[model samples]
Target chain A: MKPKRTGKPEAAAVDRDHALHLLRAMTRIRRLEEKCAELYSAMKIRGFLHLYDGQEAVAVGVMQALTPEDAVVATYREHAHALIRGVSAGSILAEMYGKQEGCSRGRGGSMHLFDQETRFYGGNAIVGGGLPIAVGLALADKMQGRVRVTCCFFGEGAVAEGEFHESLNLAVLWQVPVLFVCENNLYAMGTALEFEHAVTDIARKAACYDLPSTAVDGMDVLAVETAAARAVAAVRAGEGPQFLECRTYRFRAHSMYDAELYRSKDEVRQWKKRGPIATFTQKMKRRGRLADADVKAIEGEVAREIEGAVAFAEACTWEPVEDATRFVYSEGRMP
Target chain B: MIDGEQALRTITYREAVREALREALQKDERVFLMGEDVGRYGGCFAVSKGLLEAFGPERIRDTPLSESGFVGAGIGAALGGMRPIVEVMTVNFSLLCADQIINNAAVYLYMSGGQFNVPLVIRLATGGGRQLAAQHSRSLEGWYAHIPGIKILSPATVEDARGMLWTALQDPDPVLIFENSGLYNMEATLGADAGPVDIHQARVRRAGRDISIITYSASLYKALEAAETLAKEGIEAEVIDLRTLRPLDERTFLESVARTHRALIVDEGWRSGGISAEIASRIMEGAFYELDAPVARLCSQEAPMPYAKHMEDAVLPQAAGIVDLVRHMVNAHG
Candidate 1:
């Protein structure tokens, strides 16, 4: 077999086993998301389904760098991160289907996936909203004399928000242990980065706050993982927050109903060819790490997991409407 | 938990409110304060004075000028298992965090179908005084009181300020605590005599038969002053302070209107769609036939408060405004 072109030379020494684990993580997310897209189209799921079809590498790569204790806060596009964090694929799919056994107790549908045991805090829908939260979580951890990093994932369009700027400055000013991850899929809803920001180079925006940050080939899982690991380590060592701009593209529209008039078909097709799942699989196969059966086995397992989630959801019940106001306060109700 | 005789305490309103914040912090480890100047500066009105030293920085956090940041963070912290107390300098600064309060905190509980709870207590210095001007000197507690998911509270008396914080903190959902700036320095004695106040109930400061004056916060003082003057003229006025604004204590107001046969609402907020307006409309909607006369209201002029001391005072609902309105109602009766 012809040697695969290495777009990243430093990524060569990541070891085949770790590379294979990354491959498996991406495979699990990819197959799960594919099923989600189908279920959404088939009307098995009701509300908005912001599929992670094109953004798999960012979740698998970045999450792979963290210990389970560190907290994660992500926007509505959070399925990949939740799956990578070890929330069962069945549970996530069931949550999408609005099941009683769902992680959020069938209350938070797709945009809100929280697992207290896992420290995966959300599916926060408000743009640029999670930055402040991630800062506060890091603030709490820092005050507790505990060394932990909080990873906040947002979109490039979030840069246009004041919360993005305010939270970034506060995170650096307070020396909070937080990693600001920007999954720049070129567009925030319908607005493109170039059209929205005067300074489209998002990593440079972090420079204004004197925080160390970088831009990575978001298409490569190893690249995101390596950058995230170094960034997370620096944050935990009390060097303060680091920002990473994962320059990636989304293959599908932003939401279930977007006409996708924002970008050209060729651009999406070009990005899809560099899909993180297949790219990692091909690399691992060339290294004799991943068997064809291994890939099939992972896919088959993820599908079964998703199927179980659907069954769970189909068996679940809506929270009683009279109890709609139940969890507005914590001690007010029991989980 | 409230004993009746212990309610009439000689404590000043400021000390009472401080008591509330103190008791709330001590009662729950989850209760913490976050806002600009809440810690080191000890709050603009000094309500949080001595709190930073007493509670320490971890609990009494001094945040940046980022109202939206800290308020949103408070919402996050509430979701994260801590009962967060977020203080906005005023309702004006509160608008900065409105997206978090109104959009995220207020609606998340319902929108998530009761899956998420924002166990947050937001304290704000509201109402106009001391010549702060157009931007800083507006009362918008009514806007918050209108929201469904969260509870709104305005502590007009020392007892309410001191006692309301405990009840607000005890609540599982988000509670907005609005303290009138003008009332903080109004001294009252604090001792074992003063007891806990419930956040749900309304109290009548003065009992009368001629008419009822329902109000909250700074306007309650004006109403009481007016009631005292009305008593001198033999026009007995019943004054009810709507300590809790959201759940409203509407039954108290209805009972007052039902007995007194006429009602006057005095509010420091603007007249149009103000909280007082809501009370008056509810009376009109529910107990119209019981009225000896149409309900009346005295609210702030429908204009941004000016910077001059007299102008700002004139724009707000002062004791003079309440007294004059009551006199007019009496004269019309004659």
Candidate 2:
């Protein structure tokens, strides 16, 4: 096959396997979310379904830089992060289905996915809520002499919250190892970033705390990976926290309930033209790193995985109503 | 346990709390106290005075005036496998950190499918007095007690002030200890050997049969004083200090009410939706038939705390108020 041109300057250096892996991960997220939207329409997956249809590159790219030992604190729109961080797609689907076998025992549905084995702290529903928790986790790691990083993920809207500023200050002052990833998708559930923040340049906000920061093309998986690798490295080296602003766009509504009245179709169409999966796949195929056949194979595999996950979720049992109050306190510790 | 050979030292409630913090820091490497002015400023109320020198800055950490930030960090630290004691200056200011305390710290364990338990101890000065006014003197422990995943402690006495911190640190859940702002200077003998006390039950401060005066925190003193005054009048009153408020040692208070047949709840918080209402509800539920008179509650007036000393005293449940209420209850029933 004749090798085509690499349209983007940053896509030229991409390797075959790495490109394929990134493509597979993003494809997996896209398929899973497509299935989730289906389930929500069918009245299966209830509550808020913040699909990561257009923001897959950020989670996939960032997860590549983290180790299994490290901790992750993500926001409600975190299915992609949880999946890329080695939480089973089955469990993620189960959690969305509100099954007892779900990651959080079905107690926390779509927005509260928690996996202790993987150290995925939560699916924090509140904006900017996980930032301080990430700081404390990093503080614990520093105090315990562990050289691990705690990555906190939030939206650009979170920059306006008091906890965000407070967390950044604490992380910088205490020299805790934390990577604050702000996925700026332009809108925070109908509120545009311009409307929400006085300083829309999210990285500059972190800079006010004297923390090193970088803003990257969140649509390009390679760009996000490179920036996150550098930030995570500096944090793990004990240079203190780093802020990452992933400038991306979400093609779908903020939630299933959103009307998209805040933005126009021309704006959505413009962003969807530069969608992460299509752009990344085309770049890979043009560079001869991935072929059309490889893309088809990856899609088939993801389809089977999503189908199996849906089956697992459908078969999962419900927690008895009698045990509703069992976990309010630690039953194992207190008599 | 109190030892005979060891001498009992009389210390203020502030000193006892500081001693407990010191003991926790020394006993466990994971235990640390972080709050505003706790280190360099020696605590807002001087409860952690000299702890910075004793435990150094890392363990006796002083945070900026970001209650939500530090308190949420405390929850995170606890989840990260460290026992952190977060001190908010007062319950009034705790509203700033209420989201972290009520939403994150109190709900994480249950919401996380019981996989993550926040072994955090949050100690805040609560209750009214000293003319700090509305912003500084609100008794909001009742608000925290309404939360599920966290335990509530009101350490009214010196022994509890010294002992409850260690026990709260041991529990594999979040515990909030409310130290009344009024009790910091109150002095009593604390056994040198005083250590971790049971944080699961209420303790009877005085024994009587005429009426049961149930209370916690600083109001325990008022109930005790009322019991003494009633004793002199030949109308004996029992005083129950509810050390643990959330799990509520209902058995102890219910048994006391069963014997006394009349109950009076003295709380520094407001009457409606306060801890007094909860105690009254429990009594009505468990000891409904064991009542000679209605289970009365003496609480602060339903209004924002005033700055004037006399007005503040009039609003709160004072010793005189408890005495007057108990005398009225006994007289009406007799």
Candidate 3:
């Protein structure tokens, strides 16, 4: 089934400050991703670069529901999640540039970003690999009697993996506080949802594990935030695990190298029309909660941040060849 | 088997492992045991029997047959500051969760640039003495030792079975402990005060000068028995038990080879690309000049383990084979 087009945010409940915060977050991701594409073309940023172009609202909205103490496990396409989770743009860009100053100290590149302080487990590249880690994190919290939630972000494609089903069953059976967020972007790289899953509704599959689940309009930032807030609250209250299936789409190709033959340009154009940034911005304008000057100011601030990040990445130094085998085991503890 | 002054008691290898588990759980509140039938039903090998009633369900977790899920959970739990001892029923079953072990547990610290350390310990029953057939019986310690970042250990004696768990739990990286299925019921005397032992050295079980018989796990006993039979013929064979597989202690074995001028490796794993091959290669590299003869290896035949008793015996490395090989090597060189 085609994703239902999200309606406008409620005008009466719209707060100007909150609307701008969401818009700024989405804009920052868009500008950074656009810069990454340009860098790839110029041969500066190498390796697999997965851009989170149309799924900005999902990351921004879900992040709003999380606290500093809670943990996050994200997918390979997680530059936006890393940014919104407070990983500095300079470090992230430097990491993609393979510099020692990167968050993972150049060991992990674009597909494996990690930040210990922010509790960002990693930019796990394996499909369905992060699900069990997330479940275990929540299991640790529950066993220790700590009141913390672990939010895991993955694509709807992960639903087809055995780890997804295993993790869901384990979480519910153990009653751990995990918020499983499925970004059902209508495609698993190039395969659409219909071809990948017999039961197309991702939330329904989660509910089979007796997990509390809901589907939200992913393009509408406010709708996603509301649903995520409710889910995160239930999880924190020890009501067991919760699942949120965000009906979303991605406008760009799966990775840097793509023939674009698996999908048509018209399909991409249709999704771009309802892009997360554009739809959210227009809704705020129509509600009179945002002005054109505010939009331009946000754009200006995001542009400078992206430029500074690029400069930092360009000036960063590569890790020395002698220390290439470092971190294979913890320093000073190598066998 | 009793010491000069210290108190001593005899226990089965299974009980020794149980004592290790009990000691770890009692010492640290952060330590918990999770696996299939580890709690209420006891362990599949009955190694964790009575732990459920002693520690309660919270600490002795009985998980579903989701190996990848629970093993990955153990890694995450370790990342979250809990020491988890995950048990995969057998080496064969461990293949189900090999992705989690190889991809996540072994690579987390490096992939994350040392930002995360998985202090996780995984214990699985290995080797094939029982007629459980091909699917249930395997000796894959050699395959696991090939990977970096993780530590591979094969504890053959009651002392090692009781002591290795505590040391493995203290490691910052992942540690895999391989318990041979045949040794679970073997009984040996242990010092009442016996606690932790070093995990980085190879111990010489018996000393001699004619030849060096290097082995570990169940094969260590076979080597010892062969040494006894060779002593009657005046062919003194030194026995070396490789307690640790990875980061192998080449010094002890090299010194032995330097004195004896011959080396014989016995392993239950298949001959092709097995731990014996690795040890043989190491001997060539480190003790080539000291050796008077070519290094020899007696490993399991390159075939799946069979169900018939005689066929299985023929496929594995036995005491007769070790004696025959050692006698031939000593006589040819002498």
Best by DockQ: 2
Q: What order do candidates take by DockQ, descending? A: 2, 3, 1
Q: Ranking under lDDT, best-scoring first? A: 3, 2, 1
lDDT of 2 by residue, B1-334 (tens): 5566466778898998988888888889999999999999999999888989988999889999899999999999999999999999888889998989888998998999989999999999888878888888888878788888889999999889988899899899999999988889989886778888889999999999899999888888888887888899998899999998898889999999999999999888888888888899999999999999999998889999999988988898888888888899999997
Model 2: CAPRI class = medium
Provide chain B TM-scores across all predictions: 0.93, 0.97, 0.98
The true-versus-predicted C-alpha distance at residue A97 of model 2, in Å, is: 1.3
Clashing pairs in 2: none
Q: Stretches of candidate 3 above 4 Å error?
A: A1-11, A333-335, B1-6
Q: What is the lDDT of residue B268 in candidate 2?
A: 81
Model 1: per-residue Cα lDDT over A44-84, one tens digit each? 88788888887888998899778888889989999888888
lDDT of each: 0.81, 0.90, 0.91
Q: Worst ten-residue run, lDDT, model 2 chain A?
A: A1-10
Query: What tens digits encode model 2's per-residue C-alpha lDDT throughout A246-299?
Result: 999999999999989999999999999999999999988888999999999999
Query: Scoring model 1 with DockQ, what do you get?
Result: 0.37
Tens-digit lDDT string for candidate 1 (B16-37): 8777778778877777888889
Tens digits of per-residue lDDT for model 3, B1-334: 4455458889999999999999999999999999999988899989999999999998899999999999999998998889999999998989989989998999989988889989999999999878877887799999999998889999999999999999999888999999998999999999888888889999999999989999999999999999999999999999999999986888989999999999999999988989899999999999999887889999998889999999999999999999999888888877
- Per-residue lDDT tens digits for candidate 3, residues A205-269, read 88888888888889878889988888999999989999999998888889998666788899889
Residue B88, candidate 3: alpha-carbon lDDT: 93
